[model samples]
Target: MATFETEFLFVYGTLMSGVDNQWSLRLWRACGQPSEAKVPGRLYTLGGYPGMKDPLDGEAAWVHGQLAQLPDSPALLADLDAYEGDEFVRLRRTATLRDGRIVPVQVYMYQPEVDENQRIWSGRFTFAQ
Candidate 1:
């Protein structure tokens, strides 16, 4: 089990704030508030959810997400790790907040091979209403 250096978690998919999912609800409950943030990456639609991949060389793109403050509890981290599954790996990355502050945050990166055609050019991911 890897230790997290920061308490901030960057969420871009179902775990993002305001999503009507059980895991999202639990996340919001643990994290009282979240701020709009963006990370340098590419977004792709992995079926019903979105996955984020590191930007390729010379690729200028960003992944819009939220930065949530997580409590200092190992249980929560364990839960999150389990929820994300093996396809995603939690990594530390810098996020630019809406206020222009850059901070280190934990972000989940997609591990499987990505199809270039499936890229989400908008960067932001929103559940279909």
Candidate 2:
């Protein structure tokens, strides 16, 4: 169980498109639409939860992701927690949207103990939603 203080997130894989998802509801509440973006980091297949590291940290490559605007409030945090709350840890990160708009988005990173295998979801992404 944990908490976060932010109004945006950079969803890399499933949360993007073609991946089963129902999380966009809360993310789109703040803005009329969520932007398709890429998070500058590395994507790791950590079981069901994907792990990502920012290029700002000096990684050779940046991961691809979609930027979504979420409500910046406690209840929002709680709801987000309830959604992906347990699977990973929420962290603040800067994401470069597909449009090249830079903004801070929350990224739920998988833990170290998490395995890179056994993740059922396809890493293929799109902003179809």
Candidate 3:
């Protein structure tokens, strides 16, 4: 398993800022502010939420999200891991900020089988209100 070397986390779904979910609120409270960032991947609509996966060959799309600095707390990490459940796995990846600077961040990648038709071409996910 890979260990998280940086305190940054990239969230692309309901966990992104402005979402009213309980975990999103908790994460915002603990991680302070967030900045617009994107990772090289594809976003898909997984029911009410969204999932991210590696981009297809020669694909230049990016999964748009917010990057936040997590506090140094193991309990918080454990809680996030539990919230993600078995359908997602955390991995380290590079995120490109709006200003074009690349950063290392930990992100949850979708693990279950995906239906290609559910792909979100916009790359940015918005939870329906």
Candidate 4:
């Protein structure tokens, strides 16, 4: 029965819940609880964090993560973009929600080519505690 603002985002790495760069929680909190979603892409390890490489080849591969319905805050988006830096580029893409709804969201994609060994075979990436 709660209505949330519609600037959604898909986060799979540090920006995810309970990760190191959780400073983004301020933005996440403004959005409300994140829901599980899947996007077309592959997850790869980039040193200490993970990155998403969108195949753009339809849904052949999928990267699993949470979809956060963020508020339309320019400052917050700018902060996130700056935090992601040049390694990740933000893009708008469709994601399949847990309940089978497909919606467009802002996704930070990894822009570098990675070795096959660096890839996460499960399509899901998380920090090992």
**Number of colliding residue pairs in each model:** 0, 7, 0, 0
- The alpha-carbon lDDT assigned to residue 58 of candidate 2 equals 56
Segments in model 4 whose C-alpha atoms lie over 4 Å from true places: 1-6, 20-22, 56-59
Task: Give the alpha carbon lDDT tens digit for every residue of 28-103 in model 1.
Answer: 9999988999999999998789999999899889999899998887888888889999999999899999889999
Q: Of the pair 1 and 4, which is ahead by lDDT?
A: 1
Quantify all predictions' global Cα lDDT against the true fold: 0.90, 0.59, 0.91, 0.80
Better of 3 and 4 by lDDT: 3
Off by over 4 Å in 1: none
Report the lDDT of model 3 for residue 11: 98
- What is the per-residue lDDT of model 2 for residues 1-129, given as tens digits with 9 covering 90 to 100? 444455677777655533455655445554446567665555566545556544435544666656666654667556666776555777877777666777777787765553435332333333331
How much is 5 displaced in model 2, in angstroms?
A: 5.6
lDDT of predicted model 4 = 0.80
Best by lDDT: 3
Q: Any runs in candidate 2 off by more than 4 Å, and if so which?
A: 1-5, 17-20, 29-31, 47-49, 54-57, 113-129
Cα lDDT of candidate 3 equals 0.91
After TM-score superposition, the amount by which residue 48's alpha carbon in candidate 3 deviates from its true location, in angstroms, is: 0.4
TM-scores, one per candidate: 0.95, 0.63, 0.95, 0.87
